[model samples]
Target chain A: MNADEDAWERGSGVRVVPPVQPRKLAKVPFVEMADGRLQGVVSSGSDIARVYVSSITAGTHGFNCSTNNNRPCGGLGGSSPCKHLRSLVDEAVLQYGRERVARYLQIEVGEDDHLMEGLEGTRESAPAAVVFSRFLRHLAYLELPVTTEPVAEMHWFPATRAVI
Target chain B: MLGVQLAQLHDGDRPGVAEALDLVAGFDDALVHGFARLGEERAAALTALAGAVAASPLGPAVSEAADKVAAGSIGEEHLTALAGARTALLGAVHDALLDRLDTALGRTRAAWEESASTAAPADNLLSGSRSWLHELGITGWRGVDHDLVSSSGQTLEALLAEPRLRRLAVLLDGLAAELRASCPIATMARLPVRRWADLWTRAVLLSQPGARPAASVEPVTGRLLVLGADVHEHGTAVQVQVHGVLEPAGGAPTRLVRASVAAAKVDTIVGPAVWRLLAGHPVLLTALAERRSLDLADMPLSSSGDLAWQDDKATVGAPADPFATARLQLANANAPAVPPLERHPIRISEPVLLEDYETDGDRWTLDGHSIRVDLDRLPASGPLTPELVAASSACIGLVRWDAGGWRVQPLAVQATVKRKPVEAHTGDWAQGPTDPKVVKAEAKAGDAVAVLRERAGRLLRE
Candidate 1:
């Protein structure tokens, strides 16, 4: 076999997650892997001021899509995720990398598999205001002056327990 | 032969099959007079043995060997070869016989082909390969004889020109070599041949005469829910070292199953980094790219963590979340302290999935302790390492101790890119869309965080 082909086959078992399927990133401005789910902010496609907080966990694939004020997405009725939540995942993959998104979602990806395709769950509700607020807080951090000294606004420390 | 015997098994020929295998198995009675009297009785005994295992993959070779031995002039090794053929006919279900048979494969002349390989293909390679397999008298269990494994060495050597077959030869020899090596079989990169009969069914002689053995695995048992696996190239052979959790039947606590599976090629058609795993592995290679726990009732494992699984014993389970499963399974499991003098160890005992950790510069704060992240251990073949490490993120990683201190090889990561939380697994990290700002930020001579820190230092100087 050709060396290039050999290179292609050699140690190539681990796959590179293809770039997340092309989707409109602008529709979903903020995304993050947190709280054992993909939680993010997704702007309403029709309404200018409307934005929704969307989340879907890995194992349960339990999903939620609601406005910052807690109004539920009308598209949330059926078994499948509403478009807003789908948009949120698309952008999350873009920002975090597909494997990270899948890992956060707790799913293993297949070649040509849409990140959201493997998920199946009922539409559960969560506070959009909190997710939207986190997005705002995330934006707030970017505006702060960068310095080695910890800023008061960013003064958060993880609670620790000793490992024996 | 398996199809016939399996059908026979379905037909309730259990006792008959076992008896057929045992007939030749008791050859010491037939060979009382030794080589001088290796006349009709000896020839008939060898011939009967060949007939008894006619369903074996190596049956033709056994029959051929019997004929050659019957021609009146033969040594004691010929009788040993015939016995080996009979033993090969008996499946892995026979523990003692297969052990001796697998041990002898290393001494076979064809065993040397494992270390030597050529990129060249034989003339009429496909046809040649088909002929070579046919010449070996492979018919699954019907007639394939493992005892005669060395008899085909010369023929196999001639076909080493075929790269794929050559790879198979190397794999066979590799398995045999593992059996031969002084090191414990558990630590070997390859699985020990579980059954002498499997050699006949594996590779080109399977199902049909010349079809490749990609799936259609005959397994023993036990399955692992893959947490994560890295496909690494150590030398010539490739390895997919997997870390997974197995919840034993009957509500037992899930134990970690670390399998360093070997493979011949990346099965691109299946999923990302999914290996067309080396033949005879219990779990399906597709499991590497799946969230489902692999299906196998018996997974070949040693106390030291070496294992091989079969597809036959497999049944897919509910989807698994590697990080979550590891976190839950390894919770009370004490992280093994790095033994003194261990340096850059590839793996650690009692792997713990440290969750919700923050990465700052070279240090990662998890639970409470801040451990220095060792970048050097991050293999270069893994393209996602730098970004996964560079981005200040909430990380999930397998914690290990390096020469410096505790380090983590991130399995998945969630980072704020352009003020948004993004997630990734090492294998599929590139599948997500790239943030222009992150890319631009990385490209700039000085990164935003570094530039800011530098200005603060300049101000101190001023």
Candidate 2:
């Protein structure tokens, strides 16, 4: 069993599922796993899973996956998106609606890229920003309306949000 | 004596008759001194008098007496004739002096009557008295009086000795005494004696025939707002800024009035009433402003200082502690157990947040506006408290304008809290109720990992 699978097994029996609502995403505990990846724990009754998502890039498009039963679907480094990750993205769409979510993602991703050099690869130091960015991207992909115009500048996001 | 008789002839209507008499007395002195010495100077003095009385009844008699005296034909008859001529000549000069005085006095009285009838109350008194005193020219009071005596060429004793002038002086003295008793001397002392004399002259003129009553000044009516107030030490006085909206009787547009009352008249005049009015009890100020008069006939207002609104008639027996009386019956029932005399209300407006406040010894310095108020003098019942101090430091409140500074009232304080942004990883983040044991274990492991990371970094550097 892989580390992701082991982690899921250890937390499964004692897991407490959060309410299945978009607003409940704010209460979920997320941790930074690497420079561009974030991990979140999702539970259904007595079954628990660990979902991971990567930061968006111009060409790579990023990855999303989750552990099932006592094992990761492929591995911790899997590239394919998972049903659990899709569920979270659907929740984000329900919470923020289509247009706002898209704007939020555009602003967040733009700001992260701008500050990436100064961050010095210290993702763990800003776990909140990583989790927020992932949720924001999920909302953008699922709920945003299709538009021909390119995203504009990101000034609405507060400076404190970027600090984290 | 002849000058006095001349003055009495017309009931002292003539001005400067006494001064003319004084000049006659000087001539008598010269004659007596010249005769006692018996020299050529005496002959010269007699000859000058002979020429001066040439047109009078004694002219020929004095000229013949002078010839005998000049030829060394000294005898009792010649001497007696010369003395008699001198007396007759003095009487003739007195008559001529009275003629001039009559014309001057008529013109003066006419001018004074015109000015007095139309003058403002204070101006009427001042100008009328100044006219009379200028004519009398009494001296020996001091300062300005000395200058007047020197300028007018008269002595105090000579002016007082004249029965007619003495009577006028008595009348002026009575007026001065009345003013001194009714108003503070300190205020009057600020003016020159000539001004004071003018005030007394007006008083005397008012008592004379055809004198108009003190100018019927229209009392001001308005709403008075106290912009600021300050209480002096030991509750002796209070200084205040009064903002009023005065509406005239004939439906004139309302006008805003700003006036500052000095510390001298604060307690006795309108300060206490204004202070109380600003403290949210408007009974006294409202009554005074609305009625356009304050009937202090029964009130024990201080009679020591000059009132700011002297033009307004204040009848005796008005309410003395109007503010305190109103406050006691209504708002501040649990006020400090101090004598009413000790209470001094200071008005304040425009509450602003205080950034900070501190007390050092007996002085309290409030931040934000940087006001320093006397710790002991802050309004009673609103003494400094920890809550007030804390709120002052945290927020803004209304401060009162003092004489030249600012004062803070405890009751006028307001506190505000600042809003802050939410920080990450600070509060509970797990969605549902979690197992306590698991949570504790996770927290310990997290701490251990942080320690391990720090140790690894230090080791690598070494």
Candidate 3:
């Protein structure tokens, strides 16, 4: 747990800079189904730094995570990074320090640039408006909640009992 | 040839042309005769004043009479008096020519009516066609070659039947009034009497000698209704006309033909044969008339008013049964069984999902995380139950059972539900379906809450 020993950071013996506003981890669980993949809901609380982490990890590493071997985003194959994965990374980085964030992202994903290159290609290829929209959506997804009650609440409703 | 000869003689100045020309000259002579009517002394003085009087030894008396007539004060005795010796001779010739004017005008008008009947209704009755030449006969002589008749002796007899033509002749006659005293010749020369008179005679002869063919008439059968008449006949096919009555099967019907008998008249009647034909085959005619329309429904009526009554008659056509037709159609049709009602597709242009829903008696709640509602107050029937109501806001609701009918539900409702948040846990364990909103908010609150329970459960474990 010692920062220097863990190759995290050697404190100058002065003081570690505490985050002005430390971020919370995403509450939604990421499922990989029967296939060797990863998928999850995005929680609120993640920000740009988390988005950056998620982008690098999922996009560049080509971590085969979707339900099927679905690439890019959602069920459709595309160059842009998946909104859910971006949200996940954003949640992780916001929760942990930069070193820990890097270590965890590397563990979660083998390499970081393969899918990210595709994402970068998508960003370069898409219109500025589209890229901006995707970016904002990804940021929004990062900020979504990942807790049990919230999930249940999101899905909750009276059982649709149709009267004849 | 006569026109050519007359043209050559006229000045073609032929003596006849001059003589015919004399008609006008003589007219002038008669005008001058006025100078002779006054006393010899005054007539001589006026004749000397204008030089219209003849310069012969006997001219004084003629000049005197001419002056009297010109003064408009001549007595009957003065008119009876001749101007010297030549007065009698010129007077006689003028009388003869003036007599021809009536014959001429009458002939022209008669010819015009004949031509007019065949031409447009409004062509000039006086000037159109050969009537113009007939009119010219009185004003100037063209040696028209046709027999010339005298106006005086002509006695409007020839023109009596045509009052308008006679009136025209009288009008033309008035134009040559100067000749009345001297010889009526001047009026004849200026009038349209000659030319029209000749053409009229010809038209009359042509008209009188001819007989028109009688119109065809035959007795007809079946219903008949004359458009504008009290006349109605049944089982008769006589060519009906406004004038003539056709002979009925037994005897010739009363002669109503005289009621409307004008030469070359045209009449019309909606004949009986056509009616019989329609009655005989009503179905075919009706079908033919309606064939072009798209309606596939059966014919509306039978030949007989009642189907039962029709069946009694053998000639009545067979009735078309709708069910039989439908069965035959089904036999020929090739189509798959209609899909079950549940699978029947319902399209939604706008979809809204309720994140949460709950009901406590009357109060309703939607998604717990998002908090939308279905309804609130209980109706007379009962409060809305989540299980009883399926969708909201124009949502398609299909009955779970096969025979049930599907419906649409409205989102507008009076309802509300409670909302709460769940705490976050940073652990190496998976979480079940959690409230998406709470998870999002808790995750955003701080670092320890950052670990995703769902991701840990699915991805890392996998």
Candidate 4:
């Protein structure tokens, strides 16, 4: 290397801490349903995807992505909450209290009493306490060591192909 | 009884007059003391008695004796003469006292008449009540007599009660109270009456209804940053733009306000020197930047029509004459065609240093361009001084184009100090050291130029 490049390489070893992120989340277009659920579409360039925020249990929030093969989204695998779900819950708690959220959900479900009755036996078969215990067990697995080595050999590529 | 005894004595009756004379003789010492104390009034009384007795049957002897005493020639020192003059002198003393009382009464009547015309009833009541107090000979009327004090107090109270005069009275009272509080009572009493009257008059005038209070005008202050100056139509007019910060009294300074002055009004506003300096923009901008603040106190807000003739006069002088040699071309020689003279007025506005000056000729050099100044057009009696020439050397001159190159007939000069900062040499790779040979050549040229300038100056002086 040249003398200037050598000096720069020696200087670059000093640790650089990244700047702290702002508490305020970026604004996104969203709709509030009668059932106290939030639905929105977040687009990155040409890729548009629908996302939904719903409570798993009372006072517990979760989100799902329709475009992600009907999987739980926002880095949340159907258990622990993600940033999007947390942001939506924060916005809803700020706009409407917990009591109002509960009232709205009750009113939304009351309109379809017959459908709720059909699912009543299935809901009774799975107790809320057991589901909560299973969610906690999944969250504990995230902290356990899964491997001791690199998961895969990483490869680098040029961002764009150029004519030579 | 004395008058009856005198009458009897005058009719030559002996016993009754002799008894009265004996009684007067008994009071001789008292009479002498009374006459001595009375002085001039006693003399006047004796003189009147002498005149009255002259018409009486008392005869000329009695009147002559009284006249001598009245003239102060005879006194009790000559008891025989005094006794002979006694009847007239004693009568005069008694009559003088009565006359004094009558004169006092007359003066009182005259005083009443004067006061009746000039003083209101309130003033008379105050004066009349104070007359007795004045008789007591009190030095001041503040608290000695209650009637006089109350009367004066009532008068002041009534004056203060007047609607029209209330403000004036209050102002005066406040001033008086302040004076009384600050000074001794003797000093307040001794204050000059005329000064107090003047103060009162001014206060009244100032406090008059509809008299607008004097407006406090704060002087305008600013920093004038001259941006550019354009000398239009030669040297007749100039247009100048200046960026300034105006600091009004009791207000924040407003920045970057542009003020432009026209050339025709320049002479009357800031005079010709500033105008010439402004017209030569680079020097002015440099000086303004160096000085930071411009003193615009000499600049005027309105034009006075003084420099209106400069533009017209610039176009009016004698026409240029071609050299005689230009006319003499040899036959068969290929000569250049004579071009028509351009009549368009050419103006040069630049700062120049007058290196050489003389009555015969003068030279001004600006940015390597040297021009001859026509000095014959200057007023003959007023010769330019060395200091004036040196000062004018650094000034801007207006030159016009003519057949004989550029000529400056009327050069406007302003007195100003040129500030040049010392520049340090910063080493840069692109620049190289100057050649010593070129520097030597430039120095030789400068010396030659200086010698030529001195020779030209000497010639001009001659």
- Please, what is the TM-score per model? 0.32, 0.17, 0.14, 0.14
When only chain A is evaluated, what TM-score does every model earn?
0.69, 0.31, 0.29, 0.30
Residue-by-residue lDDT tens digits, candidate 4, B79-190: 2232334443323332332223223212111110111111122333233323322221122212223233233333334434443343233333333322222222233232
The top-ranked prediction according to DockQ is 3
Docking class of 4: incorrect
Please provide, for model 1 over B370-400, each residue's C-alpha lDDT reduced to its tens digit, 9 standing for 90 to 100.
5555443343223345556667455545544
True contacts kept of each: 0.00, 0.00, 0.06, 0.00
Identify the leading candidate in terms of lDDT. Answer: 1
Give the Cα error of residue B386 in candidate 3, in Å.
55
Off-target runs (Cα >4 Å) in candidate 2 are A1-164, B1-355, B362-371, B374-462
lDDT of 2 by residue, B325-387 (tens): 222221211111111111111212222223335544323443212344323222221222333
- Residues A1-164, candidate 3, lDDT per residue (tens digit)? 45433221111011111111123334422211101112233432343212111223222334322322222333224444555555554444443333444432334333543322233223222122322232233222222221100000000011121122
Q: Docking quality tier of candidate 3?
A: incorrect
Q: In model 4, which regions exceed 4 Å deviation?
A: A1-164, B1-345, B348-370, B374-387, B390-399, B408-462
Selected candidate, larger TM-score, 1 vs 2 = 1
lDDT of 1 by residue, A32-116 (tens): 5544567887777788667788998757888999887888888987577888887887777655567666755667658699987
For all predictions, the C-alpha RMSD in Å is 26.6, 42.1, 52.7, 48.2
Deviating ranges (above 4 Å) for candidate 1: A1-164, B1-223, B264-285, B332-350, B377-383, B392-394, B427-462
Query: For each candidate, what is the lDDT?
Result: 0.44, 0.30, 0.24, 0.27
Per-candidate DockQ vs. reference = 0.01, 0.00, 0.02, 0.00
